[model samples]
Target: MKKYSYQKCTAIVLAFIMFFSLFAGVNQAKAEAGLNVNADGAILVDGETGKVLYEKNADSPLGIASMTKMMSEYLLLDAVKHGKVKWNQEYSVSELVYKISQPTSLSNVPLRRDGKYNVRELYEAMAIYSANGATIALAEVIAGSETNFVKMMNEKAKKLGLKNTKFVNSTGLNNKDYHGEQPQGTGADEENVMSPRDVATLAFHLINEYPDVLKTASTPMKVFREGTTDRIVMKNWNWMLPSLVYGYKGMDGLKTGTTDFAGYCFTGTATRDGKRFITVVQNAKDSSGKNDGYKARFGETKKMLDYAFSNYTKEELVAKHYQVKGHKTIPVIKGKEDKVKIYTKSAINMVIPNNEKDNYKPVLVLDKKKVNKNGEVTAPIKKGEKLGYLTIEPKNGDKVSFLTEEGQKKVQVDIIAVQDVEKANWFVLMMRSIGNFFGDVGHGISSTVKGWF
Candidate 1:
């Protein structure tokens, strides 16, 4: 009987352990399947604030294919803005451009050998159809040569704070595709490369700086040089557009890229109900790795968008005029008031996960340069004077990041003085100084007496 009882107890314990193991395995599987974006690198961010919503290996540099045109588009728009280039400016194709445009296998709108195309038409072809010849043509016109334009691209990348970006050519094609006519400084087999994070940063600046580019990017199709013999119908490769096969609602202007080296890549943006999101998927493939193509890249982007819209919403975590505890007021020296009240200059709103609302907390950071040893500001404080900063952090210690490296730190708002504080009158200052001197002497005398006792 005793042996049987012991055996039964052992069996019960084994069954309990087995049940928990199965339960844990099921939960782990669910977590892994949450957002299974099959790609070499991917990222999603809020278009307005550049806050990173999700990321997967987003810092690794990889082939970007035709997305390199985004940088070209930026420079072109900047030139037009600054009066350096004009839409009606004409470009005469060089011998190298003519040869590159003649390849039937490449994505090109065949150019007439003796024809002159204006900036507007070539821009449409490059932005809408990813035409390599048109891109190189613009690069030449803007910088006098493709080689010089590449230098400008890298220079602008640094200016925009793109950390992991490099431009080998304006067209984002492999140098080998140039057929020995590659840009002067690039290698024969080099391809333009950028990390997903850098790509998203570039897109963020592009959309914010030149929103009109979306007008061309969102077009479903257009005829090159309409009403002319050389005309060809150029359809946009971004299938996620509302007029395309996938026809994702709120989907619009962005870029798509594909090559044997880059596999498939896309930088997509969409707006819905006053909210916009930007997503990038690099070298996208399926779990089986057999469906690495145009569809795969779009599919992965949809997954990220769906997850973002479903789980996150904009919340005003801190209200304007908010005063941090233990930092509500700052001492004022030689002023009419002994201290001045301080509050946040503006409210801080962030798109955060629904379940993590209570996890955030406020942190105050005072500017040491403006304050004295006692944390006091001198007289003559102006209303709304910025004195410090208020930054937000998650109490749960969750990692929060942004699309740009500079935004990696937490979001912050300015802390300013609530009202003006002028210098005290001379009579008041004299009386205060006399009182302080006497108080110090009395304290010293008291200390000496205590020591003698």
Candidate 2:
């Protein structure tokens, strides 16, 4: 009996251990399945159309760190394009800028107190290395002072329709990092802030307006002041670049940022098999909510890219010359033909989900000035004349939002006349009117005769 009791106790102990182990395994799996994004704010968008494919807390404003440089990059590119600033124009280092460059803890290409670097070199440093000193120098060169440059950055942000963005300083650094020399208009503790959506919008404009910026942005490693004692190999912080350790195919030209307040953030763009997408991940972390260095940001970006490339395909949602059912044709007054056909001026192509291929419908809107109360247009209407526009919407009646307010209203094509309608001759019009008058009189006489009978 004693031996049997001891054996039973051992068996029970083994069973209890097995049960807990199984429960722990299930919990681990649940945690892993929660969310691949692992970020405070994130978004994925169609590179060509600015369609919002996916988003999570995307509109919430947060610290942007070095990503603020993208706005600076845009303004600098504009300045160069307009010949307002020359690429080779030299910039003399200021005392404030010199002090910022001396910090070993900050990312920088050190500059001498009397250094005079050209615009192109400084820009390369800022873009590739996120160099703080180089960015300040470029800002000073463009606007004569950092204080003035911050104003330009904010103004440009507003003009671009970036609703949730504010620029406190040219660099994205915490103002206190400036050692009591922060931009005059900003508080000493303030930092630049932007929403994930705003960041994507800014990126969209940057790529569209100044595509040449990508040429420099794609460089993985470049030497600042090459062939000189001051030369330093400025490697891009964007680990997702094709030439980097976490190299992803088709990855190119973008920016990355990190700070104690912002954590890890990345704005990445990639093209594969002619399909391009833009992804933004802000404040990325591990399952435990701890910063996982550069890996966390790029890992989240990869998940977004995979989802976009795998699920979406470019499709012609509306074919050219497609006509609406009830609105296929409109009546014409005093014309050789009594009616004219109208159709879409061009095909409407969009990047849409594979499962939703047939979920869109066309909505036609006519120009009020072109059509009278009877929905008729007078004679002499030319072929291909614009009557109005046709917009596409989801058949399921789900409201779709885009990255920008303008983008939300852009899914439309022009409606045009299919053929010309010439005015009818005056003699023919007069004869037709005379015949119609007699017919009405004859019908009235017939009605009176029937009543008498």
Candidate 3:
């Protein structure tokens, strides 16, 4: 009887352990299935604020195919803006550009040495169709040669604060096959590489600096060199536009790329009810067994977009001239007034996930400290002088993090003085000294009494 009782207890304990293990497995599977993305790297960002909403291996440097053309496009437009080039200016096709236009290539607009194209035509082909040859032509026009153009690309990447990005060619092609004049200081082994985070940064700059690029990028199809019988019809390759299955309502201009080494990649932007978001996916599955030519890249993009739009909302967390609650009244000594009111230096707003918004808490961190010798804040403070910063975070028990405009994890803004405070007169100084003397005496008595307790 004793042996049977012991055996029954052992069986019960083993059954409980097995049940819990199965339950835990099911929950883990559910969580993974909800966010199962096939992309090697991905990121979703709030467009205006540059806040990263979601990311997976975003900072890992990887080959970015034709997405390199976005930077190339930026330089072209910037040159035009700076009067270095004109929109109608025509450029001759170089031997290298013609080679890039070979029919056997992945995608090309078929450039001919005999054909002279304007800057506008080249820019359109490069952006809308991901035309490699057209991109090389434009690069040559701007920097005199692709080698010099690549130097400019790297320089701009540095200016943009991209830590893990390097460009070997203006066109996003792999560098191993290039037999032409090599990029200065680069052995033909280098290929254009950028992290998904850097790619989103590049896109945000493109849209913010030159919003006009979107006008051309949003076009579904347009005829190049119209009215000519040999004019080529170019179609936009981005599938997230309104006409496709994964299409969202406000989807618009961006870029896409695919290569054997790079797999498939895309950077996309969309707006809904005045809120905009940017998303980037890199090195996604090249085939979903659908044989439709488009890989899992587009599907992964849709998943990210849907999650962002469905879960988040644009909120005005704080406003310009908005007085911070606890930090508004700052003690001031030797000043005309006893205290100075403070206000935010600028407006503060962000896209917060709807579920986390209720738990959101705004905190103001000031640089000033109260010194017993001087009493609170020293006077002669100028209005609009930067005192400190305001930061926003979620309340306790919340797992989500917010992002600042600079893409940092914490959202922070400047805290400025609302009014100027001049030094106090002699009479006012004497009154403050008397009050402080008595206040110290009373504090000593209270401390002595507490010690007795």
Candidate 4:
């Protein structure tokens, strides 16, 4: 009874101490994102792993403002790649673009009456300056109209596996132009809106599919000729481009957008020593008396980047010519052998933040039975193909465990097919000389008869 009493007293005291410490640990500055981050629907994701490094309100659907221009650029760029539009192609700004810009939406690049701009100029302007008019022009140049272009945007979003996103306009002005979460919701706006995850996925894909998009977006300054007038200097809205912090400034490009609902949002990225990434922040105070909104953004990003640099490291989780996570061997149909050791498609690596204990080892996981091997995917299997998974946490029954970073595609593991000599040795001689004698006679008789005829 005395031991139980003592134990209960100790537990009560410890609970009190923990409860107090919890509130004590709350940093007044870091706890609240503040006007610098009004209501962040943000994400700091590893560009390579598609893993969430940090998140705030990441799942909630919020206004995206001019960020929707990313989607417009995505489709327009697709059009250009597919020969639907030309960089030098000109599109006369339509009346609707002018009418749409009249709202209190983001409009750094308003169009003039009968004004014209090339597809490249519009893309540059929209990507760098979050120009509403330029985005509309680019979309029109590709889809011939905003409505049709928006449909394409939604379709593309669906294809990209963006489940919690929808597009209602070329430019991302959410209040009126973008609809709500559903197509037939009670109310929808004219712009586009999505979570941080979808945005990151879009950004990841853009960087992977069209790396040149980064080259254009990172333009600190561009002299663009528009509408037969003096060359307009399009300065980059992404403030990170001007300076590099800890060798990561080269990743200085992408998009930025702000509105009353969306607040201030910026997707900033940089690369150092081969590592590259993007940092996104949403719902922070804009330039409206907020000094330079860039400071808070860059500050947070620098911290994340610095942590990624000082602590985390990209190491090979799986190696080429090495066995996959679980499977001992892979069935090789029509190959030289009945089966071969299935190795990781590429050298799998991960950017693990430092401070993790040295004893950390990724646990191997394989359920090859579930994967549809699509007829022996040879060397150079595509990036997202199922290449066995690893467990980040060692198994402990039903306690739960995280999966390892997805396998990467780096080393070429082209499959080598070897002929089965056993199968070849059993060749039937076609009833001995039947082919030799009969084939020769058939050919000779046909030729001789043709000559006689």
Candidate 5:
């Protein structure tokens, strides 16, 4: 019996060790599933609400390579939107544009001084191929000079509330030696500087203002000035899009940047199931000159995209017409009905982490100071009228309160009245008045008797 007991005890110990080993492995995988980016700065955000899902050195200012064209792209698109320029309008390439286009090492579509291309073709070349010469030509056409265009780019950046962004040239190339027309705020360094956060901000604004740019950004390859057989083929630099090994399910266009000083950078965006996300990876490696380091930005971006789509979920936090807990009905003053039901104006959907799904708390607060200061809604309340706002916050120790890409907390939704309350009839009013008069008289008598005593 003693021998048998010893063997059973040993077997139970082995089973316990095996169970813990599997549990540890799963936990480690879960923790390591997230992105460990090898970049100077990075950020991932919800494209719709601009909420930050992940960040690392997001605010640190660094050299942004070809990403500066996003601002140029924005101004050009805005000009087109405002009827300043048409897609078919042709712009002449200037001598300055030709000189910048001479860099054989950099990306360019080779715009000659006498070359004339339409706005649509130039924009596509700049956005997809990161053609510096095409961007310069577009800038000059819009603002008459690249220097003036840089000024406009800075102005737009300021208007977007970008604190750590500055533009020296339309192209993101290092221009310290080039002594052409310089913008007002440009330093001698001559390369645009922007944090990853600011880059994401610019990307968001670009997509929001001009969604058509995505069509250009996502194109794998297209002929420049497509009617001639000798036209150059411009292929997109962003590898996260479709037809690439690292391509995600819903991966789409944004931009990519690389330089000896700036390192490898990429701002990637994707959409899945009607939800979209944007990621910015900046200064991904010091040896961006090498092939392995140049591809680090895409690898890091893929990791971030994968983690966000896999670990988080968008769920309906509050459904429409759903009665709020704690306060069931609000009192109606001088109404036939005693009270009315209140609910959210629309359904509240929130993107929460998989582990934190049940940890969030929705706190509902009525705007007593605005509509119902005295804690009562007057009669003749209309249905669907905005009563007050419902602020939903995470419970204590919950990590749902993430910072937004715009550097602010998420704003909660507002709740409204679900039904109307009609005014009370004359008979009911009269009966209530009579009851109040008798009650006042009785109170007066009781006070007088107490005074006598």
Candidate 6:
């Protein structure tokens, strides 16, 4: 009996080891499923257009984590752009900044006792490292306090049309919102939340409108106090920094974030060939709470970019509403010249939504006479001027309108009547008494001569 008991106990122990081994492997695999590493939501979109190429739970409001800093960066850049702040200006870190840097929050720029730094250095530190303390310091530097800065953030959000996003704090640090401050705790007291679509839209404007902001965001590393012994150097947190695939050529830089409630989130832009694309992934489960599901984000972003480049194309759109190839000159009366030029004014282009070269047609909307009733074109129609319009319409009925593709200076059209040409009219000649009298005299003389002969 004792020998049988020992055999059974050994068999149970082996089974237990095998079970955990498989379980650990499964957990690790889930964390690396690049597609399944799991986010409450994810999205891939065209940076040029808001068209969603791939979306999973796109509209759901989830913790954006430090992707919130993008907004702060935008507002800060706005201050610089609008002449509210200068790039070279110096600002001393206040005590508030020192207090916020105690934790490992992102944007923890090492500002010492009344640490004085240039606005440029602070910006680099905050953007490159996602330094939470640096963010707070910069906010104070710009707005005098983090509270005022958060107010500015909300205003900027509304202007960007970010309806679903809320900004309660500047650094996106843990604070309580119930007492009118950023919240911290479980999911209940969270500070910021945004949809995948809003995040991409904001990024689109940043990449397209303000390339410099993207320029700064794409920095791989920043070296402060370069030659000094205590020089601080920070590396970009985005892992896609080095190992980019064929579809991921322009894997530049962006922001990454994590917290107890927010999990891991990333907002990045990559260029393949010549096309630029943006991807946002949020609330991804850390398979073992480790390297994050970067695998899923990379795979999906590449797929999205590939789908965009392969299936979509940039089609030259030409407005074809009212266009005149060879506008004719019309004679004028009592004008600078004898005639004026009358042409059509409209543009034509193809709205290529996909890779297919679809057929197109333009609807011409012009005056019957190709000129205004008063015989004028632009403000100063010399002799002949083009004042016609061509409305472009797709055969299927969907349409877009644009100004006529025409030269800035309009050709003059004839403003006065050509009375000499009017005399050539059959009615005018028939009504001439002098010509009738001469014709009668010639007829009488011919009758007399013929009768005498």
Query: Per-residue lDDT tens digits of candidate 6, residues 85-180?
Result: 998888876665666655543346566755677788778877888877778777877788777887788788778777677777765555542233
Tell me, by TM-score, which candidate is best: 1
Q: Which one is best on lDDT?
A: 1
Question: Residues 201-251, candidate 5, lDDT per residue (tens digit)?
Answer: 889878866898888889888888667643788878887777865666788
TM-score of each: 0.90, 0.87, 0.81, 0.67, 0.84, 0.63
* lDDT tens per residue, model 3, 324-343: 76666778878999898888
Ranking by TM-score: 1, 2, 5, 3, 4, 6
Q: By summed lDDT, which 10 consecutive residues of candidate 6 come out lowest?
A: 403-412
lDDT of 2 by residue, 282-314 (tens): 898876888887988988998889888888898
lDDT of 4 by residue, 3-28 (tens): 99999999999999998887767655
Q: Which prediction has more favorable TM-score, 1 or 2?
A: 1
Shift of residue 435 alpha carbon in model 5, Å = 4.5
Per-candidate count of clashing residue pairs (backbone under 3 Å): 0, 0, 1, 18, 0, 53
Against the true structure, candidate 6 reaches a TM-score of: 0.63
Poorest 10 consecutive residues by lDDT, candidate 5: 401-410
Better of 1 and 6 by lDDT: 1
Model 3 scores worst on lDDT over the 10 consecutive residues at 401-410
In candidate 5, stretches whose alpha carbon ends up further than 4 angstroms from where it belongs are: 1-33, 177-181, 286-291, 397-411, 423-453
Candidate 2 backbone collisions, by pair: none
Worst 10 residues of 1 by lDDT: 402-411
The all-Cα superposition gives candidate 4 an RMSD in Å to the true structure of 14.0
lDDT of each: 0.90, 0.89, 0.81, 0.61, 0.80, 0.61
Cα displacement (Å) at residue 239, model 6: 2.1
What stretches of model 3 exceed 4 Å from their correct place?
1-33, 102-104, 176-190, 244-246, 286-295, 319-325, 345-347, 368-375, 381-385, 397-405, 408-410, 430-453
Model 4 alpha-carbon drift over 4 Å, by segment: 1-39, 99-106, 174-191, 226-230, 243-248, 285-292, 323-345, 355-453
